[model samples]
Structure formats: C-alpha cells, structure tokens
Target chain A: MKSSIEVHNLTTAYGGAPVLWDIDFQLPTGQIIGIIGPNGSGKTTLLKTIMGLLDPASGFVKVFDQPLDKVREKVAYVPQRESVDWDFPASVYDVVMMGRYRKYNLFKRTKDPDREIVLQSIEKVGLSEFKDRQISRLSGGQQQRVFVARALAQGADLYLMDEPFVGVDAATENSILNLLSEMKNEGKTVVIIHHDLQTVSDYFDYLLLLNTRLIARGTPAEVLTKENLTNAYGGQLTLLSKVVNLIKQNEFPIREKDSDV
Target chain B: MNDFWIILTASLVAINSALLGSFLVLRKMSMIGDAISHAVLPGIVVAYYFSEDKASIFLLLGATLTGVLTSLIIDFLSKKAKIQGDASIGITYTLLFAVGMIMISGWMQGNVDIDLDCVLYGDIALVNMDKVIVDGNLYVGPRAFYIEFLGFAIIGFCLWIGFKGFKLLSFNEDYARSLGIATGRWHYFLMGLVSLTTVVSFEVVGAVLVVGFLIIPAATAQLMTDKLKPMLLYACGFGILAVIIGYFTAVYFDVSITGSMVSVSTLIFLAITVLKRRKRQTKALLKSSTDLRG
Candidate 1:
C-alpha cells in the first residue's frame, strides 16, 4: 500500500533556532499512528508543518500523493487545546458549523444540509445536548470532543491532531479511542501527537518516535522498546523522576534559607 | 434644527466606529484602532499639503493609504524585527503622529484649514459649515455626515458579505487557514476598514474619541451578549444611545461634546461591568442559602 503521509528530510525552525532537524518518515494509510516524544521534541512542530500552518525550513510534506494545498479539502487538522483561546465567545454549534465552511462558496451562507451534517457530527461525539452551550462552558474533554466533531464534519480522508488525549477524563479518553478506531475501520488515516507512554502499545498500531530527529518508525512492538525510548528521551525520564521525588518530599531546596533543618 | 444634523452626524460616526470595532475587539486588535487613528494624522497633513482641500476625496484616499501602510509597518516590525506587538503599535503611532505635528507647525503654520488642535480635538460644532452642493442650491447634508454615512454603508455591506470569514479569522486563525480561508487577506481587509473608519470619523470626534467608540461600545456589547450577531446589535444600540445622551448633556452643561460622548461610552461599559458583578454575587448568595436549607 502507498503511504498516506510522506515526509522527506523535513526540517523546521522558529526564529533562528532549529526545532526539527532532517526528519523523514512514511506513514502507511488507514492506521492510528501515534507520534511520541519528550518535551521540546518538535512533535507539535511536525504536526504544524504537515498541516501547512508552519513552513518547513528545508523539506517537503505530501498527503496522499499530493501537496497540502492541492488536497486541502481531503485533510483535517485539530490544533492543540492550549493553542486556542477557550474564552472566545462561540457556541458549540457555531464552532462545528465552521467545519462546514469548506463546503460552501466564499460568499454563501450555510444551508440546511450543512446544518444536518454538523448536527450528525455533534451527535457522533455525544454532544448533541450541549450544541447551544458556549464553548467556554464545556469541560476539558467536551472541548476536545467539539474539536473532534469539527474534524468529523469535514469528512476528510486524513486527520492530524495535536495532543488530543491530554487532560481528558477516562470516559472521554475511551470514547475518543473508539472514535479513532471507527475512523481507522473506515479506511481513514489518523495521526495523533500522543504523550502517555503506557497507552502507546494499546492505542496505536504504528509509532513514530521523535526527538528533534526521527528516532524510530515502525509497529508499536518494534518502536516502543527500552532502547528506542532511551534514544528519544536521553535519560530524561530517570532524571525527571528523581527531581520530582525530591520536590515532592521537600528533600531539595533552591534557596539556603528555605531548608528547614 | 442645527442640533438635528449634529446628532445625526455624530450618531452616524458612532455607528461606523462601533461596527468595525466589534471585530477588532474580538480579534484582540483593539490597539490597532488607536494606532490607525493616530497614524492617519501624517496622511491627512500630507493630503492637505498636496490638495489644499480639507474635504477632498483625495484626502480620504491618502489617509487610507497611510493607514494600510501603518498596519504593514507594524506587521513587519513585529514579525521580522522581532519587536513585541504593543511596542510596535506604540512606536509606529507616536512617530507618525509627531511627524504630523511637525508638518502642521513648521510648514503649514497659520493654515486655517488644518491644524494640530483640529487633528487632535476635532471641531464638530463647525461640521455644518462644510456642505456638499450639487447645483447652486441643492444641499445634500454636511460633507462630513455624508462621508461618515458612506463609511457606515460600506462597512455594513462588507460585514454582511464576509461575516463568516471574519468570524473564523477572529475566533480561530489556524483553523480558518486549514479550511482554506484566506486569513491573511481577511486580516488586511479588517485593518483597512479600521483605517478608513478612523480617518472619516476623526473629523467629527477627535482621534482619542474615535478609539473610544471603536472599543468601548463593542466591549460593552460583548459584556452584554455571548453571540456575534446580538453583540453587533447591542454595540450599535449602545453607540447611538451614547450619541443622544452625550449631545443633550453637552448642550445642557455647555461642555465638550466629544469628551461627553466618550465619557458616556465609558460609563455604559462600567455600568454593565458592575451589573454583571452584582448578578454574579446574587447567584452565589442564592446558591449558598439553598445549600444551607438543604
């Protein structure tokens, strides 16, 4: 099968400093692929690059054998939750209606059929009741669901989401996983920027481990090994665990006067 | 009869500013209102120097060109020069405004048509003097009023046609771009509208009061409603209310009309803020009493 996403030597930078360096990967179509990385690992940058929100320094990205702009209607992107201002005054219905904006002409209003699609997408996410509620009133998981419903309304063949599972409740997580599985069964490609390591093996079929460069790219069993993780994280997990324990037990103090005995 | 035209002209200016201000407030570009209002000074001065006509269409075109230039410079400074957004706005406006001041004093000194005081604090009481004549006797209202009314119609039409694009651009820029909306062009279109509205309205309500109408009414309406359509209606309502109250109050108290109008706008915002807070406190109190009874 042809690859759904093909990145050839993709490098991206912010300001003068490079964040992603000479990364290359080819993701096969119709699978739930998770991009795992440590902090400052360019996972978000990679996603933004693929979505054409951020320009690549010296590389290219192809979705389904075509450039992003040529096939924009066939792709949907879900930005990170923190990247959007939740305090914005928009209803759940209004936001989902934005997904249908692509279907209308430049100056045309959305019709009843578009509204029907939005309603169905909202129902798919189980947020039909909260359709009229302000987006700011939603819980974290519901906010994420609103985003997913928007992507669902697009009815695209490829979906790119950045950190979709972060800070969601257990029920929301399960529902989102089921939705991903459903999409995969429909022969759509879903690439998610994921963080939690424990669920990596269960949630995703393919893993693209990244930390400034391509560390590993293969099946979960092949890429989630101890060596691959160490290569991506660089002993940061052990260091972070020790530091966390020290802070939790009050065993470390930044100031001399703060040390009680 | 004089007061009728005065109120109508001022209300028209208020409506235009408030209409464009709604989007600016939502986009967190309220400062752009202030920047454009101030930056239009040099353009007006340059136009008066070249054309020598205070109410010329060339003047409007010149001011609008400079306004768009101001936006472009701010973008270049913030994006390429790495200057922060607030600093870029401050630097661009103050520098352009100062240059305008120098042109007024150094070269165009004693020019009765345009001056520093008129630019900073407009002469709305004299708005009736500049009338547009069709033939020898046909009067089509004051030129300033017609200009402001034209501005209002253009902005309203644009909003009607491009409401969806503006909403997407304001609410979520990245998502708008992903949907293949031309976010960059929409951004420039909005800035252009802001510039045109400020230049036209500044003749009646000074540069400072233009910023007030652009932000205060829209912000007050925002506090009143959660949806975009109602927010626009409330903003226009608040703006017209300010014009009527401010005009009558200025007549009765013999004070500055522009200052009174801005004061009324600010007071309306403050009133809504206090009312919302009181409602919140009442809800909290009721919730606590219910918990105790339970």
Candidate 2:
C-alpha cells in the first residue's frame, strides 16, 4: 500500500536558525503514530510543515501521495489547544459548522445533510448537550473535544493533531484515544505530536522519536528503549525519570506547571 | 425639524461603522479603526486641495486609499520591520495625521471650504447645505446621508454574502486556509471594507469620533451576547440608539453633538459592564448556595 504521508529531506527554519534538520519519514496508513520529543524539539514544526502552514526551507511533504494543496480535503489538522482565544464569541454549533465550509460554495447556506453530519460529529464527542452553548463557557477538555468533533466533521482520511491530550481530563483522553483507534480501524491514518512519555507504549503502535532530527522510528517496544529516549531527551532524562516516577505513583496531574529552574 | 436630518445622518453613519466594527473587534484589530480614521486626514486634505470641494467623490476615493495604505503599512511594519502591533498603528497614523494638520495650516490657509475644527468634531448641522439635487431642483437627500447610506448597504451586503468566510477567518485562520479558503484574500477584503467604512463615515462623524462608533458599539454588544449574528444586530441597535439619545441630549443642553454621542456610547459600555458583572456574581452566589444545601 502507498504511504499516507511522506517527508523527504525536510529542513525548516525560523529566521536564520534551523529547527528541523534534514528530517525524513514515511508513515503508512491504518496506524496511530506518536511523535515524541522534548519541548522545542520541532514536533509542532513538523506538523506545521506538513499542513503547509509553514514552508520548508528545503524538501517537501506529500499527503496521500499528492501535494497538500491538491488533496486538502483528505487531511485535517488540530493545532495546539492554547493557540486560539477561548473568549471568541462563537457557539459550539457555529464552530463545528466551520468544518463543513469546504463542502459548500462561499455564498451558499449549509444544506440539511451537512447539518446532519455536523450534528453527528458533535454527538460523537458527547457534546450534543452543549451544541448551542458558547465555546468559551466550556472546560478545557470540552474545548479539545470540540476541536476533535470539528476534525471529524471535516471527514478527512488523514489527521495530524498537535498535543490534543494536553489539559484534558482522563475521561476525555480515553474517549479521544478510542476515537483515534476507531479511525485506524476504518483504515485512516493519524499522526499525533505527543508529550507524555508514560502512555507512549499504550497509546501508539508506531513511534517516531525526534529531537530536532529523527532519532528513531519503529514499534513502541523497539523505539521506547532507554538509549533512544536518552538520545531524544538528552540531559532532560533526569527530569523525565522524576515525571515518570510521579506518573508511576499516580500523583502527576496534567495541569500547567511553571518552574523557575 | 433640522434635528431629524442630523439624527438620521448620524444614525446612518453609526450603523455603517457598527457593521464593520463587529468584525474588527472580533479580530482584535479595533485599533485599526482608529488608525484608518486618523490616517485618512491627509488623504482628504490632498483630495480637497485638488478638487477644492468637501463633497467630492475624489475625496472619498482618496481617503479610502489612504485607509487601505494605513492597514498595509501597519502590517508591513509589524511583520517586516518587527515592530509590535500597537506601535506600528501609532507610528503610521500619527505621522499621517501630523502631515494633514500641517497641510491645513501651511498649505491651505485661506481655503473657505475646509475647517480643521469641523474635521475634528464634525458639524452635522451643516450637512443640510450639501444637498444632492438631480436635474436642478429635484431634491434627493443630504449628500452625507446618501453617502453613509450607501456605505451601510455595501457593508451589510458584504457581511451577508461573505458571512461564513469572515467568521472562519476571524475564528481560526489556519483551519480556513487548510480548507483552501484563500485566507489572505478574505483578510484583505475585510480590511478593504473597514477602510471604506472609515472614509464613508468620516464626513459626518469626523476622524476621531468615528473611532467611538467603530469600537464602542461592537464592544458593548460583545458583552451582551456570544453569537456573531446577534452580536452584530445588537451592535447596530446600540449605535442607532446612542445617536438618537445623544442628539436629543445635545439639543437640550446646547452641547457638541459629536461629544454627546461619544459620551453616550461610553456610558452604555460602562453600564453593560456593570450589569454583566452583577449578573455573574448572582449566578456564582446561587451556585454556592445550592452546593451548601446539597
């Protein structure tokens, strides 16, 4: 089968400095791939390059064996949860309806079938009761679910999500993981830029360890070994072990933490 | 009787500004309204220097061009020059406004048609003099009213037609672009409308006061609701209401009508803020009470 995503010699930069250095990868369809890296490790940068939001300084990204612009309808991207202003004055229904905008002409009203699909997407994420509620009134997990429902409503075959599990409750995380698995069962591909190391093995079948460059890519059992993680994490592995111990003790809550160190 | 025409013209200008201002406020570009209004001063002065008339269509075109240039300059400075957003707006508008002020004093010293005071605080009372007449005696309406009315129609129609695009562009630009929506073109289109609205309303509300109608009404309405369509409707309603009330208050107190209108808008915003705060407090109190009982 043809690869769902292919990146060749992809090097990207901000200003003059390079963020992604000669990154190459091929992701096959029907698998959940986790992209794990340290903070500022070009995980989001890779997703942005593939989404065509940011141009690569060299090389190119192909989605479903075609340029992103040509097969845009086949791909959906969920950016970081904190990227948008939650105070924006839009209802849940209005935002989800935006997912169906590509299907209609600029001036045309959304048809009944599109409405049905939007409704189904909202219901799938268990946010049907909050359909008319303002999006800002929702909790962080609900907001993340809203974004997922929007991606679902896009009806895309390939999904690239940026840190969807951040700031979400355990229940929301479970539901999202189940939804991602269902997508894979439907023969679609999902690539998630993930941060949590503890659930890496349980959540993803295929893993790509990265730190500004490709460290390793294979099954989680193979790539999540100590040496590969040490290469990806560098000196931060000490902090990583502390976080791992906290998770092991089931005391680490996923909330925003700031440290002066 | 004359107050009717003044109120009608002011209300029309308010509606136009409110319509475009809804998007500006949502996009967090409300300061662009202030920038364009001031920056158009030089454009109007230049156009009047050539045409020697306050009601020239050339004046409208010139000011609109300057408005677009203001936004472009702001974008260029912030994106290319690496200046911050508010500073870029400030640099562009202040420089243009200063040039306009110098032109009024140095170049066109004795021009009978232009008045700097009137430009700053518009004289709605004088709008009756600039009547649009067809054929020689057929009266249409005050020229300012017709210009602002046309602006209102164009803005309303554009918003109606491009409703979804504007919403998507304002809400999430990356998602819009990924869906192949030509996000840049839609962005420029919205900026173009804002410039046009600023120019069209300038003659009635002056440069500075127009900012009030642009930001205050939409901001006030934002506090009232969370949906885009209703927010727009409420903004228009609040704008027209302010114009009517401010006109009467000006007539009663013999004050500056523009000042009265701006003051009334500010008062409405403050009132809404207080009321919304109280409502939120009440809800929190009731929730805590229920929790205690449980």
Q: Pick the candidate with the highest lDDT.
A: 1
Residue-level lDDT tens digits of model 1 in B70-149: 99999999988989889999999999999888888786776636867777888788898988889899977788898888
* Fraction of true A-B contacts recovered by candidate 2: 0.71
In model 1, which runs have C-alpha deviations exceeding 4 angstroms? Answer: A239-261, B108-112, B133-140
Which 10 consecutive residues of model 2 chain A have the lowest summed lDDT?
Answer: A252-261
- TM-score of candidate 2 to 2 decimals: 0.92
- Model 2, B1-294: lDDT tens digits are 577788899998888888889989988989888898888888888888888666677877787888888888898998779787899999999999998899888867787367788778777878888888999999777888888877788888999999999999888888787787888778778877888787777768788899999999999999999988899999999999999999899889999888899899999999999999999999999999999999
Pairs in clash, predicted candidate 1: none
> In candidate 2, residue B168 scores what lDDT?
90
Candidate 2 structure quality by residue, lDDT tens digits, A148-220: 9999999999999989999899889988988998898998899998999999999998999999899999899
Evaluate model 1: give its lDDT. 0.88
DockQ of 1: 0.56
